[model samples]
Target chain A: MRAMVYRGPYKVRVEEKDIPAIEHPNDAIIRVTRAAICGSDLHLYHGMMPDTRVGTTFGHEFIGVVEKVGGSVHSLSPGDRVMVPFNVYCGSCYFCARGLYSNCHNVNPNATAVGGIYGYSHTTGGYDGGQAEYVRVPFADVGPSLIPDWLDDEDALLMTDALATGYFGAQLGDIVEGDTVVVFGAGPVGLFAAKSAWLMGAGRVIVIDQLEYRLEKARTFAHAETFNYNEYDDIVVEMKKTTDYLGADVVIDAVGAEADGNFLQHVTAAKLKLQGGSPIALNWAIDAVRKGGNVSVVGAYGPIFSAVKFGDAVNKGLTLRMNQCPVKRQWPRLLEHIRNGHLKPNDIVTHRIPLEHIAEGYHMFSAKLDNCIKPLIVPNAR
Target chain B: MPSTPYVSNKPKNTETREELRARIPGWGADLDPADRPSYPKERLDPSATGAHWDFPERQAGAEGREHSIEHEIVPPVFGTSVPLKGFSGAIRRHAYASYSEGRAAHWLLLILGDRVDAWESHLRSLASLRPDNPVTETGVLSERRRHGIASRFGVKRSDINHQWIDPLIVGAPWVAAGGAAVVVVRKLVRRR
Candidate 1:
């Protein structure tokens, strides 16, 4: 199997490797029909994560066909088309019962009492990831979402991770009607988070990022209010002015470690901080939100120890919610939205390259070239 | 649950005070090789209590009777326990490994039911292992509870042959009821 492998920080390569197989009874093997590079993948590729090995396959967001299943598996079978979430989870565990599948105990059996995840880490359970021709899925019943015939793989692919993460960020943000939602980093996840907030009835949706291209893309495609961080010397002040001199009701930190911001600064400044870098947007959100507001982080960060500010969070009575990705909870609803024509996340795919040119796609996406927003790797066809 | 004396059946061996100190180096110093203990075959008995601690019993073919030395403590598998508050009804509760020790211990209490007293005793015994100060005891208990401290006496003690220990506190009756008098106390500690 040919898969994209990470060579170094900001270096990725398309190389040949053995095809992944079903290792556990609840496992299933999926043939990658369509896969895309997510912001989280960039974290691993850029060496932001510690202990990320070179030559490990780099991909978590994908949709594929079931090629095989273990004897204990009953929810899915071969020939079924499914969208596999980046994080594998057992549907029957305590976390799963609460729809917190990303923290499933059986998925990353190698982790600290938490099971493994594909492409995550040794601390995260060291499962072989899905960026290849074939990917192994643990706890197949909960992780794989069956795609409706009306939905194409590209459209349903977001259900795997990106769209689900976005929706989860919005849901975690608790974007009630008439609330103003602001999302930092208008990357694919942030864009989806903004769109999900808009769908969930946020009166005004604002997105902030350093990339003017991404900010423009969110504004033009999703009708989101935009702020380019480079344009404003004081981002917090700018975001506050945009929200009637008040902060956002909810802020989604879509930019995890891959974000080129001072993580230590965020830990010291933001009271209720998320892992990874000090999300520059979180500082703005802390200044922007009402006395009692929420902040949802759906960014990719390693499991190694990180610091947070508790005093600021307590003072403002802010609620902080973060997770790997709530693919299990929101994937079904996202697929329904896609089937109903209410969501068109495929529009985020500004570049679609043949899988043969995966190496080039990685370079272009990393460089943010050719108006690239979300790039998809079509394995069989262009 | 009472703390069971960690006893083993093996042969007795002769040792000087220095040799005995080296065997259980609870204090972080190296044992002098010249002060090592020895056992002659005539005096060796494989079925005696406390004989396993004798270092020479390991050298004899009676090592099987000797308890394996390095015991790795497996942390507890914590389930969810919500504060019952004024209402005793069982609401849908969710547990995570990310929860605090007190929260996890509360869930253990709910599951242990009539055995709560026994479990509390076990926790107290574990607590007794702490220094004399109550403040230090509270801090240690809070840390262990968050991590899910398991008692071999409360449940089955892990064997020397076992690599992993099941820290799950089981046998609690998850029942339904109206209201009960309960109090929830929150404290601050180093966050993970």
Candidate 2:
């Protein structure tokens, strides 16, 4: 099997590797049919995340056919098609019992800090990712949901991370019937988040981004008003003006550590490595919302410190809820949305590259070249 | 000559902060205008999120079936007290008399004259509760130390995490003890 091996920052190559065998009875070996390049994968590619060891695979968003099943994996069998969640969790853990699958206590020795994530850096438990011909799916009974016959393979691939996480971002906003929602960043997650916000009963949704292409996608796909932050004197003021000067009821930071707004802050946080990834997006979110508003952060940030305005958030009496989306938990509702024709997760996929060209895929996605919103990796593509 | 501290003409730290606010547009942007923060910048170290496997992959059974015990989860250790409590009274005394070197094997039969589970759980509880060495006092690991050595090397825990469990398990002559305990515990729970 050929797997995407992470050599270093800006270096990934699909190399021949042993087909991952089922390590446990509850595990299954999935022959990956499709995988997506996630916005967060850029964090690993840019070396923003810690403990990103060399030689590990670097994909999490994948859908596949179960090629082999462990004896204990009764929920699935060989030849069944399944889409594994990005998380690697034990369904029996305390966190899993409570539907907090992303914070599963049993999967990672680092579970005390972060949950186990497939193909993410070591900070997320060094489970190899799915951007390969074959990948091991852990806790097969819990994490991998069988792809419904109606769901497209690309849609199933997106659901593994981006779609579910975006929907979860809106769900975290706790949106009221007529709440106004603001989402920062027009990336794929933001696009899905804005689209999902409407499903959550948001009366008005606005997406803010510096990029024109994504903002256009926000309009056409998300069906929401869009703003380019660079065009305005202050994006927050514009948000306040749009919302009757009270600010939005909920603001989601879809852009994580690599947001580009403040020059010095970006340099110190992203370049100098003095702090964690840039806090600019999160800070902008805190600044843009109403005093008692909710801020939903689905953006991926490093474990290191980021200089944030904590005092202002405290003073404003904010309700902030964030986590890596427990993707399986959101699947039922997301499937319903897909069935009802409210969402088309696959529509956002702009490019499909063979597994062999993952290096080029990573480069194009990272450099924001070719207007690549979401790029899918076809593992068996010739 | 070196006694005098160098107080250059540059402004104090407070002035530097003020100058930054005047220079940077979004410096104090979102904060309450009426309530100005006295400090401009402060170094913050969030709790270090430890996400590393300090050890290599577990060398497993030829076919990879007999993997580490990190995946074998015990029932919820919280909300449920240990089933047997008096496990400590004999296990501790005999452990000191025999395996006091903290040898990872045979203390149970020598001391409490029982399986490794009771002795292991008891010793673990003791280790967690205020050992003279301050480092041994954390209760969080009580939940962790419960993982089967195999699971630590195999299932729930990643193989890459520091495999102190491997040495700890291999060093012991009683490798099968924990696995036996699992069967016993599962059967006991099923009967209940």
Candidate 3:
């Protein structure tokens, strides 16, 4: 089988590798049809994540056909089309019992923080990702769902991570009727966060980004007010002014570790690696939300000390909610949203690169070239 | 006209179930509770979990598996993927066997093992027809062609601080390996 083998930072190439076989009775081998390059994959691509070893594949969002299943797998059979969540979790764990599948304790040896994520670094349990011709899915009964006949393959692929995460970000916000919600970053997650805010009864949605192209996407796809932070000297003041000087009722920090607004913060966190990730966006979230308001974080941050404004958050009486989205937990409502034309996740897909050209795909995405928003990998493309 | 607020008692979608079925392909396929795979689990019946014993039967072949020193016995179910092997595996086993999980030494050793495992993969790839290409794969060429240097100078790239050491980190091993290989070939030629 041909898979995307990681060589080093800023490098990945197509290489021949053995097809993954089921190691456990609960396992299934999926023949990947559609995979996506997530924004978080950039951390691994840039060597920002610890233990992102060479020869590992990087992809967490994918949908595929079940080529083979172990004897214990009964919900799915050979040839069953499925969308596997990025999480690899046991269905009956304490966390899974409470619908917190992302925190499943039984799957990862590093169960202290996060559960298993496919194709992430060893920090996320070292499971090979779906950015290949085939992948091994553990606890297949728990993580994968049959792609609804009405759902497009690309939509299912997006649901594996991006769309579900955005929706989960909004869900965490606990938005009330007529609340003003502000989202930082206009990437796929931010765009979906703004759109989901409307579904959750936010009176107004605002998206902030420095990139004009992504801001344009926020305006069109999310149908929210857009802000080019580069245009304003103080974007947080502008946010407050727009929200009638009370700050937004809720703020979503969709930009994580690699945020690039403040020079000092970006330098210490991103350049010098002094902190886990640049906390500029998160600090903005804490500062821009109204007192006693909800601040939701869906951004990926390393487990290290970030210079967050904990004092300000305490004084202002804010609720800070965040976690890795339990992707499967969001599917039921998201499926309904898709069926009703409330969301078209595939609409954000701008590029469909074959798996062979993944190196170029990573380069383009990391460089922010050619107005690429989301790039989907077709592993079986001819 | 303003859009209907989703929080209102009224259904957000005005379309009837029959209409949605007609409009969207396979729209209601899993609408039936029985058709959903998770429906049984949704009942939250503890008795239906199918586990008759207090604890699950221990999986076979747990003897050589590395477990944290904190654990008296390995957990009932643990990941078997990427089983420990090679010199890196020995380091990992030592880390697990010697130190507590809370110690930085344990984590640091594991990270070292990971780096060693990566080098092992790279050395193994060298023996294959397609050896790892340091220049293109390391993206050193992009610094020249893609304004990589210029981008670094003014940009807030987190990686820029350590850019000077990147070449040494990526190239030193390959250079050393090449020099070693040349020395071996020269000795063989001299003997001939």
Candidate 4:
């Protein structure tokens, strides 16, 4: 089977490797159809995560057909088309019972910290991801949702992560009707959050980003006001000025570890590997929102201390909420939204390439070439 | 053309598993090796408490026991007192070898377990063994909770093999759960 193997920082090549087999009773082997290179995968590509051993494959967002199921997996059968979430969870655990499936207790041995994530790294449980011809999905009954017949393959693929995470970010913001929402970052999640905010009855939405292409995407796709932080001398002041000098009602940080803006903070945190991530967008969200407003963080960051302005957040009485978006939880509504034609998740997809050319795909996405917003990999390309 | 059968010389030993093991450095002591030890079934089973043919008395081969490290997974196979919290299945598997050979009348029991760091820490504890903290003390706890510290976290005095010694409080995540170990057990129970 051909799979993407991580050689080192900034090096990925599709290589012939053994198709993963079922390691546990609840496991399922799936023949991948479509996979996507995520913004988070870039963190691992750039050597941001720890314990990321070489020879490990890096891919999490994928949709596939069930090729085999372990003895205990009664919910799925061979040839069942499924979209596997990035999370690996056992449905019977304490956290899973409470709808906190991302922090499942019976999946990753390193569960004391982060939950099991496919293909992320050793930190998220060393499960192989779906960037290959075949992938092993643990807790097969729990995380993989069968794709709806009406849903496009690309859209279903996005729901595995980007779309669901963006929806989850909006869901976290708790936007009330007619509220003004400010979102930091014009990336995929940010765009989705901005769009989802309108669905949640936000009177106005503003997206901030340095990249004109993504900001353009935010304006066209999200239908929200846009701002380039680079153009503004002070982005927070601009945000305040736009919203009657009271700041926006809700703020979302879609950018995580490698957020650009503060030179020292970025250098010390992301470049130097000092803190978990730069926390730039988080701080920006804090400053850009009205006091006592909600802040939603959906950024992918390592588990380490960041030099965040917690004092300011405290002083402003912010209701800050963040987690690895329990991907499956947001799927039902997202499925309806997709079916109703409200969201074409694939509209954000800018490039499609075969799995063999994934290293080049990673390079193109990382470089942000050809105004790429998202790139989908076709693993079963004839 | 017929191919010759490929046979290369790699040292073949006639010594018994125990005899060959004793020749290894730092053997015949109460130290347990870092990975799983290969022992015949009859020697280590708690139900078969009688000493094997190697030992003359019932408790004579007690210290020679090998402990296999098994993960006390969540949706746990055995109901244990340890709080099952985060990711629990994906773990590093290791095969350990035991070092201690001499049989003692009393066996000391030590308990230890943490979620992510338990496996590595257990090996570190095994590696850190010396005359001060003998192998008799840290025989490597298992999930069976047969008075082992890894599963239940807390070890009772009666769970010890012999007399209950003073408990040592280590500053680990396990310590917060109030899991203390009985480092010395001086009384021997006969199964014969």
> Pick by TM-score: which candidate is best?
3
Q: First chain TM-score in every candidate?
A: 0.90, 0.98, 0.98, 0.98
Instruction: Count clashing residue pairs per candidate.
Output: 17, 13, 3, 13
| All candidates: interface RMSD | 32.2, 22.7, 7.6, 30.4
lDDT tens readout by residue for model 1, A1-382 = 8776554333454566777755556668889888888766655554444334444676677888899997667778899998877766555545555555666553332233334456753334445566678877766765676887888777787677787788677777765555677888788889888777755656667887766668888887666778766565677777666654546778888876544344344433221113444445555556666557898877765443344455667798998887676465565556556665567878887877776666566655654545568888776664
The TM-score measured for candidate 1 stands at 0.63
Give the alpha carbon lDDT tens digit for every residue of A1-382 in model 2. 8888765444566667888876666678999999888989987765566545556788889889999987766678889999988987776545565566787665553224577888885446557888999888766777887899988888888888898888788777877655678999889899988887766556677999876777889888887789888788888889877765677889999999877778777666554445667898899899898878999999988766788988889999999878888787677767876886767888888889998767777766665555668989988887
Docking class of 2: incorrect
Per-residue error for A270 in candidate 4, Å, reads 2.3
TM-score of each: 0.63, 0.68, 0.81, 0.68
lDDT, candidate 3, at A32: 94
DockQ, 0 to 1 scale, candidate 2? 0.01
Worst 10 residues of 4 chain B by lDDT: B104-113
> Which of 1 and 2 is ahead in lDDT?
2
Q: Candidate 3's error at A351, in angstroms? A: 1.0
Look at candidate 4 and tell me the lDDT of residue A95. Answer: 60
lDDT on C-alpha atoms for all candidate structures: 0.55, 0.66, 0.75, 0.64
**Candidate 3 structure quality by residue, lDDT tens digits, A250-350:** 89999998787887887666545456688999999999998889999999986556899899999999999888987886788789888878789988998
Angstrom error of the Cα, residue B106, model 2: value is 36
Winner on TM-score (1 vs 2): 2
Interface RMSD of 2: 22.7
Q: Model 1, stretches more than 4 Å misplaced?
A: A113-115, A261-275, A305-310, B1-192
